[model samples]
Target: MNFHVTNHTLYVGKIETLGVASSSILQIGDTQCISLYSMFDTPPESVIVGPVAPLSPPEGAESAEGEDDRNGDAEPESSDV
Candidate 1:
């Protein structure tokens, strides 16, 4: 955003592109911070959500088509266990 300060008041904004910011600069109270901006060469392609690719399926390796995720065994715990 372009900040126009005439007596600490905004007057005009000349934004060309309209999209979410991957990064930004912020001033909060007495602290100042800057964010890193990044973008992909092309936006990701969309996928069809139909019976073939049903929504809310099990994630990760168990998500293969026609695979049975439940193997009649309790899930394994990580190091925290």
Candidate 2:
């Protein structure tokens, strides 16, 4: 397994002779982790992990005040509402 450290957390992904192959995300609060595995019939290889940009809030969301004219971000926070 290989580890990639980001500004916020770490990530684990698969690597190959060509480069990184596939990756699955694992997160704990703001941290991240991933594990790499090899098949019994396959030979061991080096895996590279890289950083990724953090995601941003959805677009059209209100800054803070509730003044959405289009109601784009007016959805209820919970089903009880």
Best candidate (score: TM-score):
1
What is the per-residue lDDT of model 1 for residues 25-45, given as tens digits with 9 covering 90 to 100?
433234445548787565444
Error of 1 at 63 (Å): 13
What lDDT score belongs to each candidate, Candidate 1 first?
0.52, 0.51
Tens digit of per-residue lDDT, candidate 2, span 3-31 = 87667555759633545444533334554
TM-scores, in order shown? 0.21, 0.16
Lowest lDDT sum, 10 consecutive residues, model 1, at 72-81
46, model 1: CA deviation in Å? 1.4
Error of 1 at 61 (Å): 3.5
**Model 1 error, position 17 (Å):** 16
Q: Give RMSD to native, each candidate.
A: 12.5, 21.3
* Candidate 2 vs. true structure, TM-score: 0.16
Residue 59 Cα positional deviation in candidate 2, in Å, after optimal superposition: 56
Q: Which pairs clash inside model 2?
A: none
Top-scoring candidate (lDDT)? 1
